[model samples]
Target: MRLEKKVIIVTGSCTGIGKAIAKRCVAEGGRVVIHGLEPELGQEVVQELGPANAVLHIEDLATEGVAERLVAVAVKAFGRLDAVVNNAALVLSSNLHTTDLTFFRRMLDVNTLAPFALIKAALPQLKQNRGCVLNIGSVNGWSGEPDLMAYSVSKGALMTLTRNLGDTLHREDGVRVNQINPGWVITENEARRKHEQGLAEDWYKDVPPVFAPSGRILWPAEIAAAAVYWLADESGPISGQIVDLEQYPFIGRNPPKN
Candidate 1:
């Protein structure tokens, strides 16, 4: 087990990529603190991973002081914290014309500020364990699409936060921080979102190559696999890095031809 005895907190873990990460962590012999907005899903995940290896905490991270509560749960359950995967995020799409301060603040509060609070709350335990933090960022952080103005801006800030804290904590506290910017992951939430947007249930099947290069979108488990490497001791003190998980070059890409 690559992560034998390690204790990790995976926020937004009740579903999507976060869910996959919690499962992967336990499968690799780690204990985990599962968190999300859905209590039932959180409980189900804890049950699936077994109570001994996992515990659930349902939190709206945007709430002030909740980050500390999450850390406390981890410590209370397993007595230590080895890593934290800041994977919980709110992804709302809005173009410049539709974007407003309310939406912008909501996006930043959940996507950016919450992660910062969690890291700060867990810093002491992390320092003691020589632990690490893995941030689930998005390729959209690179200026995002016109339809995702606020979301893109939030992710860009998150990327900056990851780099800033990764460097600061590594130097001052021995806690490694890293990020993964994933592109077009297929998940229950993503599917629901598409359906809400009037796409067919199998809309992904007909997506253009520009959207899904492999004739399919990325899977949550793939991100989970990469996350383990960064969270585990095997990464060996590396920090301040971002991994872009996508099929194409993020820069200077030629538009797809018909």
Candidate 2:
């Protein structure tokens, strides 16, 4: 019951990592506002977490006023907000040649700008409660693959936002801000993405050593487990940090050429 009676807002929570975090928040005795684009999926998550523990909001993060609405939902339902997990992202494959201005803008809108907007919208409540923020970034933000140019750029901007606000917000408002860059995680969307890319059904099981050093990629539950510490009071005044959650050192690691 680390988060007992606390209220949290988890975006993109209808599925994937966000869903896992929402569930974990409930398991730890916290209330959550589950947000996503799909109404059916959002309703399902609300049902799973139960009406008392969770509420559902279906909308695009890029939409104006949606962030405020989300905050309103949390405050109206649970009375106060303790934490916010910015996990909603638009993951698309685009290279220098394929990424147009609109594509890049959309990427930034959802991945970077939306998080900033939400943070700003929730600032008052967070300040009142002395709550924290957790931004879910990706290891791709470091350099990224060739085909992930726009996505990578968006994440890179988010990393900078996390660092900038983490320091200023923590010092000024006593609200901590931190980010976690997750490696390859086997989520439902990832599985479908691989299949859509022409990989076989069991593609995750045969991942290369360079990608899955532990013989398998990460699990959503594992990320959620690590997330609890940051969200809980146990973290204690730490801010302006980016922790990469990968099996190996992401910055510089030369794998054996077998």
Candidate 3:
């Protein structure tokens, strides 16, 4: 396995992309610390990932001291930290004109600030290990989304943060910082639940082809593979790059399934 003996932390492991990342890391022989808001569910994931490779830490990353605390736990339990995937985010579908200051602030606080703080907290350890960081960014980060204005701003800030940190650390600390901008993935559980809730049968039909002419929603496992590639035995000059999860147009390809 490529990530044998590596130690990584993935936030928001309760659901969606975070859960997929955690599972993939463990399967690749990495030691992963899965963070989620719910402890029981997190533990279930940890157990499924097997005894030695996975552990769960439940906490809200947006809390004042949570970043530092999570870092401490990783160091204390795993002995070293090799990578961090900042996957936690908050989204609100609201018009910017009517959205309150509090609502906007909350979006920034959880989506942008928490990731920034956590990366900083994990920086020294990553430096010590000469490790890599993969931020879970968004397509909306580069292109503005009218409905998700606050969320878009937060993700945009995160993309800029990734570039800034990647620039500084690649030269000085040997810590590679990159981001993944995933398009859309429909999980089986979510799809089934939404179907039960009377959701449209072909709602995703309207979403952009996501850089690829092929009209298919990107899978959670697709994003997981990208994370593994970054975390694994990768060589070559890699820094400050945004690995677009959406396929490039006319290539007729899927992302590297490491």
Candidate 4:
């Protein structure tokens, strides 16, 4: 197993890419602490991963002290942390005019501020263990998405946080840090919601599934594999880097430029 004996903390493990990452980490011989708001689903994920491989944390990460609570729990249970994947996110897709301050602030708090607090609390422990950190950024972090202004801004700030922390850790301590920005991945619930909202066409046309030059939609498993690979590998040479899961042409819907 690539990650044998490693202890991994993955937020948002109840569903989607986060769930897949938690499972994959366990399957790769890592022990995981799964975090989410849904107690039942978190327990279900841990159960699905079997006894020794998983545990659960029901946390509203947007709260100020939630990260400290999560870290304390993980350390109390596992004794030490080998890696942390900041995957929990609360998204708000609103234009400037349509968006309210409350909605925007909440998005920033959840998507960006939560990760910052969690990492800060985990830093001393992680530094002691020489552990690594992986931030779940978004394609919106690197590119401009007008529809999701608040979410995009938060993700962008998340990238900045990743870079700043990565640099500090890599230089001062042995800790490594990186960010992963994934493309659109369709889940059953997401599809159903879109269909209900009469936005099926929006999803279908917008999410092209071709990889790299293919412009295809990203699968959750694909992003999970990247997470698995990053933590499981020991070289850990990459710090302060943002790994964009979208291999598609960054400029247009077409293949790579010749």
Candidate 5:
């Protein structure tokens, strides 16, 4: 029960890694407020966690006032906020030429700006409770794939945001912030995206070892485990870290074999 009695807000929690984090948080004795764009999916997670442990908030981060509203809902439901996981993001594919101004803005708004708004909205409460923040960044934050230009830029901004706030807030208000940049993860959304992109249903199972060094890509639960450690008191006041959760070192890689 690392998070016993803690109250947390997890955006994009209707599915995928966010869903796993919400479930894990509750299982460890914390209450959660789940957020997503899909009402049906959000309700499902709320029901899964039960009324006693979870609530739902349907939000589009592109909309104004939603960030403040999300924080309010969490505090209203649980009486206090102990942590927030900024896990919602737009993971669309776009190369340099394909990334128009509108597309780039949308990516930044969802992946980077939304987290900034959320942390700002939750700051006062976090200060009061000495709470923490967890940003779900991506390995793309580094150099990134050529196909993921705008998305990569957004994540890079988010990484910088994590470091900037982590340093400032912890020094001033005792609020800790950290980020996790996970490699390829197999989620329901990812599988569906693969199917939509003409891949077979078992595409995940057949991933090449070069991409999945452990013979498989990561699962949502694995990321959740590390998230819990950062959110819990056991992490002991450390802040401003961007942890890359990958099996292989991403730097100076050789091109794939023919």
Candidate 6:
């Protein structure tokens, strides 16, 4: 029970990595506020975690004042806020020519700006409790594939935000901020996305070793396991760090040639 008695707010908790983290928090004895746009899915997650361990809040992160509402929900349900996990994102595909101003702005609004808003809204409580913020980013933030221009740009900006606040907040307010950049993970949406892109239903099963060194990509539960450390007191005084959760070294790696 690393997070015993702590109260956390996890955005996008209706599915994928966010749901996994919420489940893990409950397993570790932490209560959570589950936030997402899907009411049905959010209710399901809240049910799965049980009413005593979770509360549901449905809202689009891009909507004005949604961040403040999420913070309010957490405090109302649990009486206090200990941490926040910014796991929601818009993962749309677009290239230089395909991504227009509107599309790019939408991506940034949801992916980057929303996290900043939530952090700001939760700042007072976080500082009072000496709590933390964990931003879920993507490995593509470093320099993404050609087709992921807007998404990549948004994630890169999020990375910078994480580092900047991680340092300043820890120094001034004693609230730690950090980030985790995950590689491709096998989530429900990812499977459906691959099928829509014309891959076989079992495409993930035969992923190339270059992409899946362990013969498979990551699982949401695996990422959740790593998240526990940062949320718990065991991580002591560490802030402003970005950890890349991938099977192999992401930078300066040479794949074998046939």
Which should have the higher lDDT, number 3 or number 6? 6
User: What would the C-alpha RMSD of candidate 4 be, to one decimal place?
Assistant: 3.1
Model 5: CA > 4 A from native: 254-258
Better of 2 and 3 by TM-score: 2
Q: TM-score of each candidate? A: 0.98, 0.99, 0.87, 0.90, 0.97, 0.99
TM-score for candidate 1, please give it: 0.98
Residue 130 of model 4: what lDDT? 81
lDDT of 3 at 72: 85
Q: On residues 105-137, what C-alpha lDDT tens digit does candidate 3 reach at each position?
A: 888899889988988899899989889888998
- Which ranges in model 4 have alpha carbons more than 4 Å from their true place? 200-216, 251-258
Q: Which residue runs does candidate 2 get wrong by more than 4 Å? A: none
Candidate 5: deviation at residue 233, Å?
Answer: 0.2
What local distance difference test score does each model get? 0.92, 0.94, 0.81, 0.82, 0.93, 0.94
Clashes of 1: 0
Pairs in clash, predicted candidate 1: none
- Residue lDDT tens for model 4, 50-153: 86788788978887698888888788887878888999887555888988989988888898888888888888888898888999988877665788888888
Error of 4 at 31 (Å): 0.7
> Each candidate: how many clashes?
0, 0, 0, 8, 0, 0
Q: Model 4: what TM-score?
A: 0.90
Put the candidates in lDDT order, highest first: 6, 2, 5, 1, 4, 3
Least lDDT summed over 10 consecutive residues: which range in candidate 4? 207-216
